[model samples]
Target chain A: MGYISLDQARTIIAAALAHGGQLGLKPLSVAVLDSGSHLIAFERQDGSSTLRAQIATGKAAGALALGLSSRRIGEMAAERPSFVASLGTIAPAGLIPAAGGVIVVDEAGRAIGAVGVTGDTSDNDELCALAGIAAAKLKAQNA
Target chain B: MGYISLDQARTIIAAALAHGGQLGLKPLSVAVLDSGSHLIAFERQDGSSTLRAQIATGKAAGALALGLSSRRIGEMAAERPSFVASLGTIAPAGLIPAAGGVIVVDEAGRAIGAVGVTGDTSDNDELCALAGIAAAKLKAQNA
Candidate 1:
């Protein structure tokens, strides 16, 4: 299992926040998980609505579980709404097929976890996740 | 505002983990949310899936937003599938209204924040959350 420490989570969050601040974006909610898709840490900025973190984590988990990016899931869902609906029935709440989540791959290119961001455009969310993964020296591991 | 700082969130997670260990539960995923429903922190045991935290937080946020437990939402959903479906459509993902979440109430009985736990039965999740709140000395902030 890819060991994920809280410190690393903090680093990823720090990077995301810095980037968001640079862009003058809205407050963001981020979720970071270990290689096994277990939570390492999370943070939500002030003024962000309660839904932000849930959405972020959902995107991240969807990537981790699917071994792909949530953006891919979004594309797939767009093509098959009914199937995605069934998936919602089976999956936990907040399983969005959005573009803000990407799987994290270790140095060996093995996916260990994922990072997700919310409270901005889907493109921005995905960008933040990718940047955090890169800062950690991990691959995108996106599908 | 039920100010649930990251430090408090960490405390809640530790309390939840210790109790879960004592109870011989599988690894748990815990979520702590502020009054605004934004996530303050989360932790998932090594073996837990990424979905746990998202599930737990949604359960807790649903409770806070509606001022009712997820259990109550389960019953309500059965009677109003359309309402629930629209909820899913209109709200970000993770809007499941289910059991296993408790509102953090202050001395004035105001709901300030909430803690949600998963990777266990709903009863166990609720117990762990209540224990966390107690350990944090954050008695139900708003009743």
Candidate 2:
């Protein structure tokens, strides 16, 4: 049951903030989803717009449900708009197929969970996620 | 605003659970909707039925739109079935004119939002919502 825990969730969020601030990024919203694609914990930085929280959640859920980062899904979604549209209705809340999610992997390269970060550029979002994964002392494979 | 935060949302949910459990009630779903009828947060207990969350949200939205307690609306719905039936469709997204919603007020006696609970009798649902309101230090008035 060590897939993830509250402590790890907090550490990851802290890293997101520390790294994001170091880069002078805007306030961000971050979410951690359990293997079941349900929200474990989420934080919307003070003064961040309301939509950031919802978008972050969607990106994280997208990663877990598709078993891949939303960045890759974004390309596929663009090529197959119909598929993405239908899936939006069928998907869990906050499952946006975009470039904001990164797979949180374990030692065996198994995808254990995922993180979604928002409040900056798409590249910055991915970078913040990498920092969070590193701070958690777990492996992350960019997708 | 300072009237509510995620911490307040979590605390209100805890109050609802404490009240729901004491009555030996079925697992319940509780929702808090902000003044604009946007979902602030929601929770369904582990054993709650799947549709409970939708029911709870609908109830909260109904209260906010009508500016009244759902319990009072339930009474009117019983006598004026036609009005509620028409209302059910007039507003988008299932709005059940039932007694699971109660207004959440700020210290200034203004309705800032509502809390709704479902998965038990109407009385039980109202009980949990009231408990949440009281615990959150918000006014539960005119419902």
lDDT against the true structure, each candidate: 0.76, 0.76
lDDT of 1 by residue, B7-71 (tens): 67778878987999999988787888777676777776766765776698787877777776667
Give the per-residue lDDT digits (tens) of candidate 2, residues B32-60: 77676655556666544446756887888
Q: Judged by DockQ cut-offs, is candidate 1 incorrect, acceptable, medium or high?
A: acceptable
* lDDT per residue (tens digit) for residues A86-114 in model 2: 87788866567777788787777777778
- TM-score of each candidate structure, all chains considered together: 0.62, 0.69
Measured with C-alpha atoms, the lDDT of residue A48 in candidate 2 is 65
Residue-wise C-alpha lDDT for candidate 1, range A4-123, written one tens digit per residue: 565577678778877888888888888886765556778777667766766887888777776778999999899998886677567653568889888877667788778889989999
Model 2 alpha-carbon drift over 4 Å, by segment: A1-69, A78-86, A89-95, A100-143, B90-93
Please give the lDDT score for candidate 1: 0.76
The alpha-carbon lDDT assigned to residue B112 of candidate 2 equals: 80
**Separate DockQ for every predicted complex:** 0.32, 0.13
User: In terms of DockQ, which candidate is strongest?
Assistant: 1
